[model samples]
Target: MGEAARYDVVQISDFRLPGGTTSSIAEEVRAQSEAGLSTALMHAAGSVTGYPIPWSTHIRRILDLPGVHVATPRDRLHATVLVIRHPTVIWSTPSTFDHVTADHVVIVVNHAAIDGAGTRHYDVEATDRRVRSLFGLDPIWAPIGPVVRGTVLQQTTEVPLRDEDWVNIFQMPEGAAERETFIGKKPVIGRHSRPQPGKWPDTKEDILAAYPNSPGYDVQILGGAKIARRKIGWIPDRWTVIPFGGEEPFDFLRRIDFWVYMHHPDLREAFGRAAMEALAAGCVAILPPYMKALFGDAALYAEPHEVLALVDEHWSSPEAFLAQSRRAQEFARSFSPQMHLRRLQELGVAVPETGATRQDEPAVAGTDAQAGASAGPQPTFVLNLDPQDLGLARELTRGLSATGSPVVMGLVADGAEKDPLGPDEIRLPGPPAFHLVEETGAGTWRRYITQRLRRLLADVGARRVVTVGTTIPEPVMEAFDGQAVEHHWVRPDDGSPLDVQLAVRMNAVSAIAADAAPETLAVTILKESTL
Candidate 1:
């Protein structure tokens, strides 16, 4: 045989074990390795672990896998710089990209809300920019579920059942054995989630109060620290608080009859993996109205006040409970690892036919004119600025105006007051475009601004856009997607007026060259930097 095709795939994310929990992105990496892809998992930041757990131990544990390789760079910044030079596919988990540039990047979003709390937290504009910066293309977003394998649950042994406890019913694969067939005398209600403020509803105390010290029912709170911190006025005998780490989530979930998640409506879960895992373990899930789209009939919807009543209704009727449990189990199967792999393939992600070694190629370097010539015909350039940076924008505009390149200035109107200019006013050679993005209570105005900036760039036929600001916002950096366009970020404190002008001009030229010869541009920049 000649040479085997390389199956190199790198996953960059916040991965930890033992004291900390692993994200769904890490799980996807594991699945990819099992499918015959040569996979490497790198920590987005430094080695993540609980106290007393050394980084070497974590690495050793992860490397034990047959085809999985693990690497923890000095820090996130180092990893970001390293991946840009690597000649292999790089996958970044949610919201890790900073100022670093990459050619082939696949970003996976695990949650709906990105920046902060509430439904509007989905910073559509920033997400779009992030996709563009990583992929060098426009994004077409679609909701894709995570790949949760059965193996995540297999690590922990099963907890023995009690005669007084009612087992949660679930549907198995075709022709699989029917393990559970009876309902117990007492109901064992449970809640499994990170014990965070957002995950709990405002009426948490009321729900806990419902499970009083009685023979009919008992409550168990799994996942999180001791319940003493909650200070919910309930007797010690009423409920059991199982802190994380003693047993795996599935082990605790398997023992519970119902899996209730009473998260606040404001907090959005991109895809509730824990709830899905509960479903896989045959626990009938109780979710809020917001989760309807994700879980469908797989879970029972209940308001905060109706939680106790809903549980009572299910407890009274065994047939109805079993049907819902079976539905949830079936729905959970849809998020299988195999299904995720196929979805990735459908999205045009390359999979190597045969495993082989990675090719280490040095980047090519060239001058601005040569790079521009190779990039094809010269195109228009725009200088974008936040309203606060209007002074620098003016200086850069005046200096670059002499270069004879068709340059325009654009202003982003954030909610904050502008020192010199009003909302609609900013002086420039050509009519300055004002993008008014008012901040609503939803906290997503940055996204709106990013969207407007993208539209402005496209409208002006901007081949290269230079942003002059104190510090470029991550969202704004992301908006400069598309192979036809190049984005350069210039800080106000970089140098004197002449320095800024020269830098802008050079960057403009560099952008033109970058469009034509990315490899040459990378080599040139790498040579200049210590990295």
Candidate 2:
């Protein structure tokens, strides 16, 4: 870019990095435009990897380019070329560039975008269509790959079971923990499948009715918050919604009884992770007929949309689900974490078995910290209220209370504080199950109420902590440091981040513990005597 600039000046703009997008970019472009410099617009394109980009984000970047008119010889020499496109912006959502306006858009396409079959064939088409619909023009589709196609999606290889008995983990709808024991344990049926369109059982009620008369049979539904909510609505009374009370979904997957493939016929996968996990857990795989291709005779196959039939005939028949579970264990004894890492390394991704990726470590840690409240077993759950968003709060409380004893600490403006449930308070789904802790402050400033919150958490329990704050507080962060419970911050709408974080943290810690100290971790694996 500098060499081209030596021949002629260039000022690049983008929606990534510091000041690449947002008001700063607008200010920069406005400054240059006002300075009478002739500017050229350069736009970059690709998938948005991880950073959050919305439809109007590109406009912010375009607004920051100062030389939109025409660059003079002096302008060309002195002008700084701002390259706004980076890997992060490309891998994210595609419709993030609708509002952007550029005189000339230059796309920096990477090899992944150019040569990858998934990207070039499907993703690129979808992205271009979206851009055209929203922006009234199509950006360039530059191919930078060396005209070579990579391998088809990899197949799963089995890994050794860490445990003879099946263990599964998953995030619950309400932030809660669940553990169930099958007495006699003769026919333990582990289901690690999800509800998919037209593939999963018609409803939770119908699925629950499967093997209704059969006693000592349990089915645990594992999923994140959305799935948890759906399960709550559809769960068969016979099947229990077990909250793998953890910060990460994988933690719940780690402790499941066995794996069931519930994907719809339309959906195809290169590899079935949950099915592989069931094999790893020494459980049999009861796969849908369609996904049998992915597993072959290694797993037990059943028709889709027939969860009840499968449960009654295949799972409920004498020694059926159990027999299949053992076969699954034997099948999944080759795909280790080391193998996954090695594959990524061969792809030039340089994934080390230990240490961290230079780019992803801090962000991952920060994300984990934010998602997993650094709390111990008996930690306090903080609930901040803005009289307006009480509906959301009540929904959270209802979900939490169903799984664990949640301590709700409500914060309000000085004069606004009233009966724990004020005259204007919306009726909670049920009478408040939470122990009410109140803090009164001058306003919604989180800093002002941090001291009161720290005291409240200490008084309750500091082992496991979750907070719902309208705003992030410096004091609360300090309190988290002191208490060590995973802390999470959520906007009013995107509340699931907290749930997923908790699920992930629990799984990671469980993995770390199981890998490091198998004996101690085994005892805590929810057995009769331990419970």
Candidate 3:
């Protein structure tokens, strides 16, 4: 592997490695920049809070390199194994998927130069599937594992055709029922309950004080020290307090009366994995209202604070609880593992044979920004406003002009305003390179947005459509044609208010890229220079 006079090549790095694993990736990239080599690094999206969100913040920081592009390790490993046959290959990013193949190969570079770990490990099943696709397999392909396990489990059992009288509820041993047996199902709280401040009390004294026990009903506290500490003085003599160990959480769920629990306020809680297990095990569950996003109507939602109140209303009525429990069982049965596979197949992701295969040649398309003619008489951006967005709209146009970009601005109306539009209304720090026009009309809102856009694009030959916010609406995405509009999902950098600078930037570059032939960006504004 010597230097080449002309070639397009990539280098690889694993950012998730231990400090000493592959530290060289960064230095290798810096060296390549010095040597005039094209390079990119691979990083996974950060994992979710409880789930270990893939492509974590760490990966994001690493890939924010000035000139480097980002790729996924899952894709890279596949390319290395199938196409390069080497220990490493520059993992291809989503943007680069169609460009590379097994036949046309290049030299592999490691992140060791930058002290990068070789390749980070992930779940074998997930990695294998990603690798298969990188090797030119159809994206719809998958490996057999839990997906299959779920199917096998579903096949061996039979849920009662109709709702059963007894419903069991299972969940994390964190919180217990505010009011058990609100409906027909008895409350079978988790066995591994942990005591957390505010949510759980050190003793059930508060709960008992809140509600004196009636007949046929008892409260049990589950989990380890967390549960024991919380239920210290709370548990009644009749109810059994069990310490859950190993993966027998579900086994305990099987012995439960009903599932009752609440979720965190973030609304990111899992939809009762234990509840699902209980439903399979023939238990009814009473869910918190927030769970509708995941469980739908399968579980009943009691207000988080109204547990005892719920027991008084729903639990006290055994007939009502039984009916609700039946619904839960029916709903759980609908999500059998075969149903998952069937759904995937329906989505065109599981076709046994797809016509998608790797091409011998690279893609040639309009994907990159064309080294264009010099910036024209600064861009004159026209901020077209509807009646609702006139004020902020004006501010946006003014902001752009203030940034030294030429901008013309206006409002859309059903009819033209008789009063002449003034420059004070249109001009900000910078002047419009051309005349700013405001027009109003009916039955032409789409035409108005488009015409204003085209006018601005043409006047100064603008290269981008930068909007002040996402509230610009769905119609805009459709009007620009789905192929061209790109949303800039901007998250705040300084921990500003969640709503603070949410804007959209329609990248003419990406529009051109999508429209490009094969992999080559076919159309770009050719920047011509003055003599």
* Global lDDT of each candidate: 0.46, 0.36, 0.35
Q: Tens digits of per-residue lDDT for model 3 on 415-455?
A: 21221133422211111211123232212333333333443
Ranking by lDDT: 1, 2, 3
Q: How high is the lDDT of residue 79 in model 3?
A: 27
TM-score of each prediction: 0.50, 0.33, 0.31
lDDT string for model 2 (1-531, tens) is 111121111333333332113222233334333333333333343343234443233243342232232121112122222223222343343424322333322222222332212333234444445444533544443221212111111111121111111111111123222223322354344454433343244445434443232455655565422443364464345554543222233455445544555543334443444556556554555665655654667676665445445555653454665566555554554432343223223323323334322221011111122222344233335354444545544554444444443334343321212223321121111111121223322122232234445544544443444344344334445445545454433235533343444434332122111122223322322121111
Candidate that would win on lDDT:
1
Residues 118-170, candidate 1: write the lDDT tens digits. 22333444545555665455433323331111111122123211112111112
Per-candidate RMSD, Å: 19.3, 23.7, 23.9
Identify the leading candidate in terms of TM-score. 1
Clashes of each: 3, 64, 66
lDDT of 1: 0.46
| Model 3 lDDT, residue 73, Cα | 33
